[model samples]
Target chain A: MSDLPENLKYAKTHEWAKLESDNVVRVGITEFAQAELGDLVFIELPKVGRVVKADEQCAVVESVKTASDLFSPVSGEIVSVNEELSDAPEQVNDDAYDAWLFCVKADNPAELDTLLDASAYGQLIAE
Target chain B: MASYSTVSLPTVTTIHKTALYELHIELGAKMVPFADYQMPLQYSKGIIHEHLHCRNQASLFDISHMGQCSLKGSSAAIGLEKLTPAIISRLGSGRQQYTVLTNSDGGIIDDIVVTRLGQELTIVVNAACKEKDFKHLRKQLSNDCQLQELSEHALLALQGPSSSHVLQQVAPEACRLQFMQACRTEIDDIPCMISRSGYTGEDGFEISLPNRFAEKMARILLNFPEVEPAGLGARDTLRLEAGLSLYGHELDEKTTPIEAGLSWLIKNTHQSYPGAGTLLNQMQNGTEIQRVGLLVEAKMPVRENAPVFDNEDKLVGRVTSGSFSPSLGRPIALALIDTEAAVIGATLFTRVRNNLIKLTVCDLPFVPHRYHRS
Candidate 1:
């Protein structure tokens, strides 16, 4: 029931990626991921311009009862981070699709095909 | 496949299962062993969702592992009065009050809920100490009254601000009842005892039904748009936010009701009860440590058993229960601190892991109670 756009790619860990201009990919958690971790109270975002590999922990979202790690979907150099989430992390829970966590310049654009497409990611979560 | 050498493993203790075990599994709950019961710690919707859901709407909780029993016959009230400090004889029908079971030396055995149901008195004890409570009750009470354990029944709690509305949709009669009142009713054709009482400090009800009909009743209740199945993890956080006491942490054999600040439950008119004299002595001379509420001034929570210190760095007491109160948007705790440091505005410190978190003694029930007293 999450808003999984067909044009986007997703990681098995639940992060979503949308390719932007200039080889930059905008990354954020899926709606399903935010719903699974309700009422987010705190978020620890990675510094901007930091290099991160695929599956690396890029952020932390602490809910009322538990804390969860936000993983990076592709190897990239962080170009810009969502500084707004530092003050109001619940914006992610309110609208996960629109609240981008960060933007990264991928080392290789071909890495996008290595991630699961919208339909495949939906099928994976259905299981 | 080659035969493998057998390794010895620790024997698993017999854990009590709830009536909604199948439903919990179907919802993908994370089961954990707690107090000899296989209880759900959290569900697939997760603890934060469940906790917030209970505060905003109604959440169904399976608390059937708690012990339920009835004391019957003519002399039941007088017999029970002899064991505990609560004035049971003064209680009328449909009245519920908190009381404690005390040992011979005036120490607490366990805290329990006592309800007067017509001629018989119904009691709910902690699950871990039910056996000990039963054995003590047997020895103290006269043979005129019979003690009957209702272990075959399952207890369900539907709690939140909207619980009354959700329950009223199915059973209209429940809407007329005030808080702490109990009545026999039918839900989806299953006869049950519904009490307008809960631990969440919200307007809610606790229903006791036959074990076989528990799942059906749960399904019927969950059918309400506002109701969701919550687990034990949220239950603990909610209770702590309400400033309610847990058995092993707040109440135990070494502590008395007076020290736990539960002297309100003990009636001075109850002349012949055990622990009355001891409580009177403590009231006059005062106890060493007193339980008080603390508001932590930090983001990280200070969990149980955290050492409490004064501004001068002297150890005063320890935290019994601590958690990030979902309703209050800050971490809070209940600690038993030195009587001198129990002032409402007294500054204190709780050592969480390696850091000394600043705390201040404050009023209880971090969130305002929403119980429908009327």
Candidate 2:
């Protein structure tokens, strides 16, 4: 079973969003997503302050075998991104929840209601 | 599931199913379609871990889909030697050699592993090109000889530093065989053919057994603490690190063994063999492009089909195979380039998407070979 925390919301694409005070929701891929990708070698994330729509591709993670896109769960303006991942993307595989991709100031916080909670996400992936 | 903005997702094709499909799924492996089989590309342990396991310990691989056969007759040696450049007649009993099935014009048809087993010769060819290879061999050899395809057999490769030790527990005599030698042995009262050869450049064995006994043999081997089941993804990367060539990438119909840097397999004494004239001529006047190894300076890997450029940014060739070599902890590749451009330490550039990654021509077998020759 994947280590999905109860504090965050998840997208069906396997990304997690954690609310970080006020309207900011920090985003990152789930552990299951990184494990499926194997060893990550390169990552291309969107620039800071870039406005991204919900379900839009916000980043790209490439492993030795294949490349995958990271989608945003809610419409938001990017505030901060993990610059350390530029050199060591394997950290995402090590701790997906901790290796947050970017912090976005969500345009609509109510969009979180549509996302699955930790228990619901667990039930969804269990199938 | 919450609805999201729609985007064109990459088409996920139907994965081709393999004979051991259920077994892989049970092991929690990541299955992918490769060549026509729904093979296990990696297990839950991942490719790098599986690759390192095969180097340090033993790893079992399902290679049953590869073609295997036996050629028998009084004129089998002479008849087969006419098609390949290897000196098969001179190979001693229980000896194995790597040979190329060649075209009349000296191009490579396929690379095969040929083993001499007294009155008959056992051969293993690539899975994808077996049909074409069998048809060509049938046409080239005389009717006095017989060719029997053993498609019903399951082939498994047990490779690593500890392979011999693990195999000795079952077949004690197998521990005595030297590299490139083969013998018929009984493992736990089951009949099988064991060859002291493998693609990973480790001390290992390729065991051929009846289909009915394959699952059992696999279970028996996996019982050993040192052995684990690896998938095709690790197999490919391990072979690449060992400087071994794959059929579609390095060995192909348009390339010759000489051009591929496998000229040593062409014996000097085989003067009357097929393509000997063309090979000897190429030997006298070296080939235009020679296969060479590359060491990428950056962490980003240069995958297959990436264009290679010279110092002046002139396109010289393309990468045939490339990967992040687990053993070396860096990116390595094999490329066939113009002879003048293949010099060691020559600065080259590999076009990786929009960025031009710098590379250097380095020696192959990025990891030192650990085969047990004694």
Candidate 3:
């Protein structure tokens, strides 16, 4: 089992969201998700200013084996995108927590409480 | 959420386990359902490492899921010639030839490797098409030929540049055999048949032995420092880089051998064979669409079924097989396209999602094959 960061909240879909400051939340895929997907060759990040709803498909991640859609955990407008992923997508595989995919200005900060905690997210992956 | 890929999923209820199933698990392999069998997609080291390890040193692959069988009779060679385009009778003893099983309509039923061993001929067919291939052979061949499935046998391939150096430790005589040659040998007092050929385009050996001894043999081979276990994931990338045609991807019931750029395998003689008329015609004239390799300029991979287009944005073909080439560190693919657009240096494009990626129609084999030929 992979380590779950206590400070971050996780979606059942495998994306992790961290409340940075104010209403802004940083998001990226969990470490367990990267292992399952294998070496990342390509990543399509959601553009800045793109308004995405919770549980809606916001980005795409592709490996050598297959491509997958990444869903947003919280409904918000995309404030910032990870442009570095365009050149080096393997960084996510190296450090999933450090390589955030996008930052969202959350519409409801209370949605973070609704997400799974560290222990809960660990249990979901264990099953 | 990640969508499940059907590529590695098992559709059937009855699943088969290979002889090295336990060994694979011991090595921390991530197993997936493939062709009704639980196969390792990669080991703990991952696909890229496994692939390069095979290229630089040596890697052991469990090919037990592939069907192994023998055709024995006085007219076995002649009987096999009727199904494939290769001149089976001309294949000398202790030698192997790559050929395809064709239907009457000039379409490929399965791609197989046939080894002539004295009076009997042994064939290795793809796992998914083995049952159907045996049925086809039983119905089409004459009564003189006898088909026997080697179900109790396990097939293992040791592939890489250092394969011979590693195998020479066990079977000395097996290393003396050149490429495409085969011989019955003994390793650790166990009877085994080894062929110096493989799908990875390396100097390797495919060892066939009884199922009871498979675990012991794999353990002995794995004990070597150069040999590490590779899985189906690395196997796919290696074969694609070698520019080999896969059964379902580059070939199928609807695709002919000639269109797949395998005209050299067909004998020049006008011998009677399945789909001989169309095959001979396509050989003499030309095929409308020819299979070629594509080098993707963009970083993203162009997957199978992606529509290919010409410079004018005209629909030309579809990508049959595409993957990230670990050797080249870029995306490579095989696409069947119009003969006019399928030149050595012609530019083509493929649509991936909303992006139209530029691709160049280059020669087959994004990476060179290092086969040890005498």
lDDT of each: 0.85, 0.87, 0.91
Give a tens-digit lDDT track for model 1, residues A92-123.
98888889989889888778888999889998
Give the top-scoring candidate (DockQ): 3
Error of 2 at B48 (Å): 1.1
The regions of model 1 sitting more than 4 angstroms off are A1-127, B1-12
TM-score of each: 0.77, 0.88, 0.96
Clashing pairs for model 3 are none
Per-residue alpha-carbon lDDT of model 3 for B121-187, expressed as tens digits? 9999999998999999999889989999999999999999999999889998999898999999889
- Model 2: colliding residue pairs: B16-B38
Best by TM-score: 3
Tens-digit per-residue lDDT, B163-231, candidate 1: 989987888887777888887789879998888898888899999888999999999988888999999
Query: Candidates sorted by TM-score, descending order?
Result: 3, 2, 1
CAPRI band for model 3: medium
**Candidate 2 Cα outliers beyond 4 Å, as residue runs:** A1-14, A22-25, A46-58, A71-78, A104-127, B1-22, B271-274
Ten-residue region with minimum lDDT total, candidate 2 chain A: A58-67
Where does candidate 3 stray beyond 4 Å? B1-12
Q: In order, what DockQ does each candidate have?
A: 0.26, 0.50, 0.76
Q: Which residue pairs clash in candidate 1?
A: none
| TM-score between candidate 3 chain A and the true chain A | 0.97
- Chain B TM-score (model 2 vs. true structure): 0.94
